[model samples]
Target: MPASVVASAGSSPAARVTIVLPTFNERQNIQPILQQLLALRDRFQLELIVVDDDSADGTADFVKQMAHGEPCLRLIRRVGRSGLSSAIKEGLLDSTGDLAVVMDCDGQHEPAAVAAALDLLIARNADLVIGSRFHPDASIKGLSDKREGGSVLANRLARFTLPRYRQLSDFMSGFFALRLDRCLPMIRQVDSQGFKFLYELLSISRGNLMIEEIPLTFQPRTYGSSKLDISVLWDFGVSIIHTLLLRMVPRRAVSFALVGLSGIGVQLLISNLLILLGFSFVASLPPAVIASACSNYLVNNTLTFRHLRLKGLQLLAGLVKFLVVASLPMLANIGLASVFYARVANDTLFAQIAGIAVVFVWNYAASSRFVWNTP
Candidate 1:
């Protein structure tokens, strides 16, 4: 609940605005983004809450050092758990501002756009304002085709699957702002288990939500690796499924199983490719099995048990536990699939689906119990 500010021009007080930065290994970009955001303190009351995942790069230490001088700066160093969506939620819950803006720590989001997005909340009475990269007047720099293409596909899928969100052109963009009073209730209610919290917000506020968008120029990251992977795609799919089957199943279990199902594709593709490259099925099997397990671990950590996500040494330790738990099921998957192939007459597709389904259940139960057991 730390709030800091520069003196406003008039005798009247400035409205509070909190910028929540959810970061992991973003030490290099931290100072620069802070400098930019700190420059805006004169115009509006600004507070910066950096919820970090215990970055080995000393991101939290640096923020603590900076906070000594900048009263508006606060750092929440999460030691055992980490996730972008959950980090944002932590920041939001701690924020004291009338308006809260969520942005990236990678410097991809322009700090300059924050004021304009905030203006929509204060003046235009917008329930939520998005800094849209796909806006007609927007520009982008250094965005990869793979990431951009994924964003496009995610947006399209969200629109097609959840028609209520069709009004948003950039459902995946992380930069956005809303009044704390308006968003806090929804944030508490939604399944905040995945990376795309904004999409979750939009989906939850389907009726009578006054949403607006402003053009924002997307820029390249100043430091750290992009978090995008096949797991992110799977997480997105799980979010869509969560939206579709809101009341039908336990969100975490369903999402975890869905991510495992996606990993089946990874295993099959890698194994098949190796076989095509002249490797024996025996030779290709181990790597394919391991790779699929790794994929599942990554996705489950980031999406399924996100609130209890691991970081640094804990992340590595969790992976080891995941592999140990997953190996048995991986073997079972091969055996079951083979058994189905041998017994079933013609429907190979059904056999494959049944095997995947069985393994999915096994993986989910084991992972939930051992790998990511957080209370």
Candidate 2:
């Protein structure tokens, strides 16, 4: 631990501190991190909760085995569900402590920072204390240059969503502490499906909370591979959009709209290509429409409604149901576009665009309720 990661001596030793570690296939990393956190029990009343996302690697089982001997250690095994933000939310909600700390089990988030964060939460009388990698005194020797650059860009974007905490250096940091009493109401209302739980908390607080930051020494992961990928970035982008929209629109709906826009592009591209190949505009439209609907269903399964993602036989079933649910809207899109092309605009692009717009809401609502069985 660096000198900058000093634990505050000002906090009360009797204060119950709950540390929430969200894990996914992090079997190798859990034990070491738990041991380090348990070491803090001598100074603070510590309760360690490992929220495991049904890791096939038996992460939950490992925690359960350890909990058998250690009263402070507990495990939450979530089946048929996955997502870092939700896991953290569930852990925090289940916490039986006055103060709560949320961090990663990947070993990248330094366990030593928890005490320092807790101290800041008490000493400064702040509602939330974030462990920021971008803090002036912070160090992130473990982060790659590319990852660091991406994080910097993400923090900049996050500031816009959190107008009250615009001075925050790391809106994306997984390590943070908060006074649970002040945050519980907001936590309950947080969009658990969002990519970043901290961002959701900060955004929901609307700067009304007295938020502060502590320097964090982000370490390299020693066990599992990094989960940062294109999908995570896509979710991050959607989160930003959700905040920007004043959160009036559902997060899933925002994702659906974005995916629908991509589908529109696919439809227009294929429709124009077929027309150029000597197919009549009307004849070219149905194939293009069907193709775009298929693209939307696949993308939606992977991104928009990932929590209810279908696989193997279920995936085939979902695609069939998606098409069936979409059939009426598909007909509406084609008929409206064809009418516009023949009578109103006499322009294929304009007609198709108008047609797609007409059924956008119906497709989202119907598919979500019927195919995905989600409201």
Candidate 3:
């Protein structure tokens, strides 16, 4: 709202654009991207918000130092926080611009494309304008064959969740521009934990927004290494599932349920192996149950409740707490199944399934609150 920030080169009224750059540890790449973006100030009123997740390499501090002289430049140093989508969310929400552009700070996303994307957003009166790497006219020399293939597969899966915007070539693209006022409602519903904020926005909008795509020329990063890892893939898969489930189920619940299914597999495998080894059914059951519970606890700690993941002494203490909280449910499972099997029906499978369902609900609820301290 400063007079200087609103001033544009031309007489035509300029839309104040907030260019949000989400960074982790891009100290090597930040300066160049910032300079390129700032160069566009003559054409458009621009506000550059660098959302840094407390990078160990002091990416935030560098941005802070740079912001001292530049009135349009600002830095949001997020301590004890991470994730690209969340950072983008925070940046967009904090923006005072009429339009917002979210892009990578690592230099893979072309800074020049910001102007084109914003222009298209205004020209087409679109709520969202995506800078798509997979657009037919778009050039992608940045991603390797493997990464491209993975992106292709992810976009395909993402399309299934987005029936209306299925034609979008790059749902996984990081660079995008949006009319902030139009997207504000849907943006609030977007899951910050998602790996792709565009996908989250598209899915949450439920085809209400007028969307368009602009060709993006993605180049390889010059300084920093790629953030692509197994954990990112895992988060992407979770995001897809979160969309497919109609956002009715909490993402953590889905992960918890999957972990529970794995626990069931462990229990069955162990129990069957024990039976083959001449152990009695009753004798094998306890060890198998205990083994499955331990497996579930460990996996839930690692993936289901990863944000509040236990470590070292905390791990041992959490395991103890998990077992204690799980005991009542474990007992109820056995008790309910026995009652149903003995009194109501002789169907062992039906009784066991009913018990498993109870155990899953109880364990997930109890473990979330007690074991992980998550609500």
For candidate 1, write residues 276-329 as lDDT tens digits.
Answer: 999965566668778988998987787677667788999999999998887887
Per-model TM-score on C-alpha atoms: 0.74, 0.96, 0.91
The candidate with the higher lDDT, 1 or 3, is: 3
Question: Which order, best to worst by lDDT?
Answer: 2, 3, 1
lDDT of 2 by residue, 97-200 (tens): 88889999998888888878887787787889999999999989879999999999999999877777888899998989988888999999988889899998
Model 3 TM: 0.91
Sort the predicted structures by TM-score, highest score first: 2, 3, 1
Candidates in order have lDDT scores of: 0.79, 0.89, 0.84
Clashes of each: 0, 0, 0
Which parts of model 1 are misplaced by more than 4 Å?
Answer: 1-12, 259-367
Checking candidate 3 for backbone clashes, the offending pairs are none
The candidate with the higher TM-score, 1 or 3, is: 3
Query: For model 3, how does the per-residue alpha-carbon lDDT over 204-296 read when each residue is reduced to its tens digit?
Result: 888888889999889998897998876677778788888889989988888788788888888778876997999965566567777889999
lDDT of 3: 0.84
Compute the lDDT of residue 169 as modeled in candidate 1: 82
Better of 1 and 2 by TM-score: 2
